[model samples]
Target: MEKNKAYFVVILIQLIYTGMFLLSKAAFDVGMSTCIFVFYRQAAGTLILVPFAFITEGKDSSPLTFMTFCKIFGLSLLGITTSLNIHGIALKYTSASLAAAASNCLPAITFFMACLMRFESIKLRTSSGIAKFTGIVICMGGAATMAFFKGPELRLLLHHHLLPSHAQLNVAEGSGSGSIWVKGVFLMLLSVSCWGVWIVLQVYNS
Candidate 1:
């Protein structure tokens, strides 16, 4: 039952992320500044989590050292601020689905980073290791496909005709060159890499 609940939570988180990508793209279309969006996002997250951390763990936790504080700050900078800023910029040039597709690389990137940091072991002779390696390879391949292949256009059921004129204009403005798509892909990859680093650091600190 507990395992089932955990799986449900993971699925819920993915749904939330999907919504975030779509909603963020809409926000960008309305001329929201990426930097300002990131600033408020980080601020809000800090406000929420700080109090929760204090309430839940403050009494039980040991005092934080200067080194520990630095690590936590670095993680926040890379994971929250840098990642979200890049994501916002990328969304301006690419579709929400494209951005979400690129994000599928996150787990694979995190796995490799953890291996590099000696936090995860890989034994090629073992079945589990082989499966893990294969899955990572597949994920990387999918990310590459998303980066290079434009594929067929997916028409929405509601259609562009239903959208406001300004929204249509925004969509048209954002649509263009292969170069812009490639740039967005690179930015997303960079953002995911930063997130992967944060994951490794978080594990180390914990």
Candidate 2:
């Protein structure tokens, strides 16, 4: 039952994340500033977590040392502030699908960072290590393929066919500039790298 609940929670989170990508893109279309969006997001997150943290661990938590506070601040900067702000900017210049696809490279980035930090070990002769290595390589390959390859479009008969005039205009407007797309991709990758570093820091701090 616990395992089932965990699986359900994971699925729910994934759905929420997918919805966020779509909704964020729509918000960008309507002229929302990325800075304002990120500010509100972070503020709301803080409001939600503060009460929960106080209620759950108010008295039981140990006193935070200066180093611990610094670590937490660093984590917030890397994982929340920098990552989310850059992600919002990336979404403005790229399609939601492309942004999400680029994010799928995160596990590979995290794995490499973890190994470099000595938090993860890889034994070439061991099957588990070999499997992990292969998985990371495959993930990198898939991310690169998505970034570089634009295959033939699968045009489905939908509302676009019914309203071809409006659809064509919308399509033209939605087509982002190549340079801006490249910048967005770079920013997305940098955000993921920051996230990977945050993960390593969490492991080290733990």
Candidate 3:
């Protein structure tokens, strides 16, 4: 039952991410300002999570030091604020599907960084290590392809149009623009790299 619950939670999280990607892209298509969208998104998250965090962990947690507070502030600025801003801009120039697919690189990049930092070990002679290495290679290659190639267009999932014709056309054109797509891919990859570094840095905080 515990394992089942974990699986359910994972599935739920993926569904939520899918919805976010779709909605965010739709908003961008409809001419929403990426900066304002990111601001509202972050503000909403803070409103939802801060109260719960204060109630559950405030009393038990040690008083934060000035230096520690600075570290956290810097980390949030590097990891969350900058990353999300770049991601939102990238989403403006690329399709949500590409954004979602590129995000899968996060764990791979994190693991590679951890290994480089000596926080994780891998023995390439071992089966598991080889599999991990192979997966990472594939992920990097896929990201490169996404950045450099403008593949054939994919058919829409729904037969009926959900967005206005202009919005749909804008989305399609954005995805197909070689220069803009490359720029978006590079930004997205940079954002993922920053996030991976953030994940690694969390160890020091803990």
Candidate 4:
């Protein structure tokens, strides 16, 4: 029963995440600045989290030190602000498809960062770690190829296109060459690094 409940919760979270992503992109599409959108997202989430944090950890928890609160706020700023701002700016300057593709490396990249930080073990002898490492390498190879290659042989997913979404974003309209494309890719790379660092820090914090 507990296992079933856990599985259901995972599925529910995924559905909610999809809904939120669509809503967020729509906000950005409808002439909202990414910073403002991020502000709203963080504000609303913090409001919800406050009660839950208090109810869950109010008792049996060590006294909250000022330093701890500051660190938490700092982590939130880095994770939510820097990450979202870079990603939003990147999306404006590039096709959503490429942005999505690069962003998809997030989970794998975060795990890799955790390993590099020694929060996670990187032993090839261990099947789990090796599996994770393989996934990260594959994601990186795919993303790097998409980012660096300018030749016909490397433009496969480019030609394939992303599945059309409700965002009404016509990724098909992406011009093959432009300065914005370079800027977007670079910004996404920065966002990816920040997100990975944020994940590593959170893991250690927990």
TM-score for each predicted model, relative to the true structure: 0.85, 0.84, 0.87, 0.70
Candidate 3 lDDT over residue span 1-206, tens digit each: 88799899988998898899889988988899998999999999999999999999999999989989999998999899999898999988877877877888998989988988889888899999999999999998887776677677666854566755444664567564777787888888888988888899889677
Computed on alpha carbons, the lDDT of every model, listed in order, comes to 0.83, 0.80, 0.84, 0.73
lDDT of 2 by residue, 1-206 (tens): 88799899978877788888978877776778988998987788889999999999998999999999999998989898898888889888766777777777888899889988988888879999899889988988887777666566555654655423434435754576667777877888888888888888898887
| 68-163: candidate 4 lDDT, tens digit per residue | 998888887888789988888776655455565676788877876777787777778889878977998999889877765544333334344342
**Global lDDT of model 2:** 0.80
Q: Which candidate has the top score in TM-score?
A: 3
Which residues of candidate 3, in runs, are more than 4 Å off? 142-161, 165-176
Model 1: CA > 4 A from native: 157-176
What tens-digit string does per-residue lDDT give for candidate 1 at 1-206? 98799899988988988998987887787788989987887788889899899999999999889998998888889898888899899887777887888788999999988998899988899999999999999999987887787776655744565333345644665567567778888898888888898989898888
Residue 187, candidate 1: alpha-carbon lDDT:
90
